[model samples]
Target: MKRILPLLLTLVMAQPLGAHPHVFIDTGLTLAFGPEGRLQRVKVIWIYDAFYSLLITQDMDLDQDGDGLLNPDEKAQLTGFDMQWVEGFNGDLVITQEGQELALSGPQDVTATFVEGQIVTTHWRDVTQDTAGSGTYEVTPYDASYYTAYEVTLPVEILGADQCRSRIAMPDITADLDALRQELFALDRQAQPEDAGLPNIGAKFADKVVVTCASS
Candidate 1:
């Protein structure tokens, strides 16, 4: 299936555009634990900004009546439109334990809807690693190239694990942006940041949700 957003092509190319994030997403996360207290899955919720939502609606020919709401048929057509990810795509989510990134299965239980002129979507990702005994984990959502910005604006919930709790660690936007600007200025006029071996600065600006378990 074709992806719903064509701008994703630019994101995958990772061009050195040197521009701010064009697409904004308000992200929500729910951590699900298994009977043994291991991290089982993550339920992700994405609410796109109004402008981008409008673009998506236009691209899909949805909301033909311009009523700012999707009917049943439109909702069905919009479902899973963003789930058809390209190869090497990380789904913009990262889960790490002790600095080692854990593996996650592809998106499942995908659903989508149109609400108040915004696009809202949800999906599930199974944590394929055994994290039962791990006391702490980091979950981050970001676009490496900074093409899209993800803000953990919604509440973070822990499910099936009373001992586990989550806290959001927000980055220092001013400091991060200052550093990015210096790096960009250091680059030769003809050289792109990627060509200059600059690291993924987007990670520096990401909000990290730290999940800790008192008893595992």
Candidate 2:
């Protein structure tokens, strides 16, 4: 696993400058269910934006020919580069059912590829316990400091779960930003907006995947 840079970790935990997203990713989710209709695992896909991809490739000296595609050797070198999760990192994914958060194992079966000048990665996470039969499960991806923005642009797939259906719930950015600003103002009346310590407002701007299962 690659260890996250210390400066990056600090920025992610406490963004004193303000809560704004610097990197963007198009996220995809695939929920897997066992034969008994219980939730088993989740597959997470991340396609990074072109600017970030360019930075990564340039930093790593990949695609030297400037063709915008990585060869087999370069692809192999890029695999699992983001898997080096620091301690207590959650991979920016949150899964909860009935208002209780679920435990998920660390990333596994990781793969990475560069396509169309973007870095695309996929990994699977096993649910530590059974969680599907009835009720709704909410899967949200977010960075607490709002440094990375994730949008559910790809298709949400339900695999081996005929009794379950999934839908995307888009958040209202304008309203959420307004609420956050008010809260920040309440926190500090004299300090400037940039100087006030920003709260963990990433979830407010996240797109949620709501999974509903028919009761057995």
Candidate 3:
């Protein structure tokens, strides 16, 4: 558990520079299937940025040993603490099969570890149903509020699917920026940037991995 006084003071005393994603995460994903070739689960790994890593280390008392690193017990505690999500937070991962979205459950087998002054979290969750399709299915991780920015740190791994291929499609930030500029200029005097054009610009900027499997 996090210390209340420090956590509260840290949150309240510091002024935010801007929007939500004051934290950045480098993300990795692995898609796994059962022997029958149906989609079973998705594993995700998040590596925190340096500043946030420092904050988390303090909040979680990750360096209890005073050697400036997380010990075994601290690592276990960190995993459990970070795995807890606030109500309605969907882990920021999405999946769709042939344009139909599939609901994903909560994370399991979660573990958090400290590596070279950074906090790394890994977990997996099962998808709702078997995805059977030759058409494109997409997996993406993003915060709709743009509170946290995510970068793909590794190519998405595919497991247990003999004939499937996956490719990553990254969003064009330049195009999104240009579009946002146009929208701002087109706005009326009373218009707000939030309401001007694209609401969830983060989603537009999210990186997606497209997977296609041959029909058995």
Candidate 4:
């Protein structure tokens, strides 16, 4: 109602209204694997408003590097739209540890809760879509370190795990878009008019990035 009142008054006051709400999205995920590439730990961090929360996360290895480092072949395959590499979870996933390999079948969902208050979670469930998007990473047993990169896209939505299906409304989409354009089209701060620099009309927003995530 607080938000709605402002909108209604805008119409009555004949004031210019902005069409947007802000949803600052920040997410973090951590997963651990055994010496021989066995699933272990999962951690997730999701931030919205001025508050953020986290959950245990699960990951499917798309490719493994033998040299204990991110290899060129692996990077090349994950690059662009027409690239293919030794992607795991595309169909099957194998975790081998202590001279034994275990196969995990089907979609893996990370069940967790989101607390609105500072103490005792205000909500609880397994919000699977929070882990939406494709993630790339490799582990190095020699050093016990891993590296990863991911892109987030729409279509794949995050709803609390075990919770009933629901719809979410966001206002940040517009603000972010506008901010992006102005930032990208922004003129060089150090450039002078005599330098034939870019026009001072300000930056323009480029295209939005949309990523897809599939689990099986």
Output the number of the TM-score-best candidate: 1
TM-score against native, each model: 0.85, 0.84, 0.81, 0.22
Per-residue lDDT tens digits of candidate 3, residues 86-110?
6666888889988888888888999
RMSD (Å) per prediction: 4.1, 4.8, 4.9, 22.2
Ordering by lDDT: 1, 2, 3, 4
Of 2 and 3, the candidate ahead on TM-score is 2
Candidate 3 deviant stretches above 4 angstroms: 1-20, 64-68, 131-134, 175-198
lDDT agreement of model 2 with the native:
0.79
- Backbone clash count, each prediction separately: 0, 1, 2, 15
Q: Per-model C-alpha lDDT, please?
A: 0.81, 0.79, 0.73, 0.25
Stretches of candidate 1 above 4 Å error? 1-18, 174-177, 181-193
Worst 10 residues of 1 by lDDT: 1-10
Query: Which predicted model would earn the best lDDT?
Result: 1
Candidate closer to the true structure by TM-score (higher is better), 1 or 4: 1
User: What are the clashing pairs of model 3?
Assistant: 20-147, 21-147
Flag regions of model 4 displaced more than 4 Å.
1-21, 37-43, 50-109, 116-180, 183-216
List, residue by residue over 110-210, the lDDT tens digit for candidate 2.
99999988999999999886655568889998876556789999989998878789999998758768888566535432333345556556777789999
Candidate 2: where are CA atoms >4 Å away?
Answer: 1-19, 174-176, 179-197
Residue 126 displacement (Å), model 2: 0.5
TM-score of 4: 0.22
The digit string of per-residue lDDT tens for model 4 on 103-214 reads: 3333233232323421011111221222222222221111000001111212323222222122222324377656643443343433332243323211121111221222
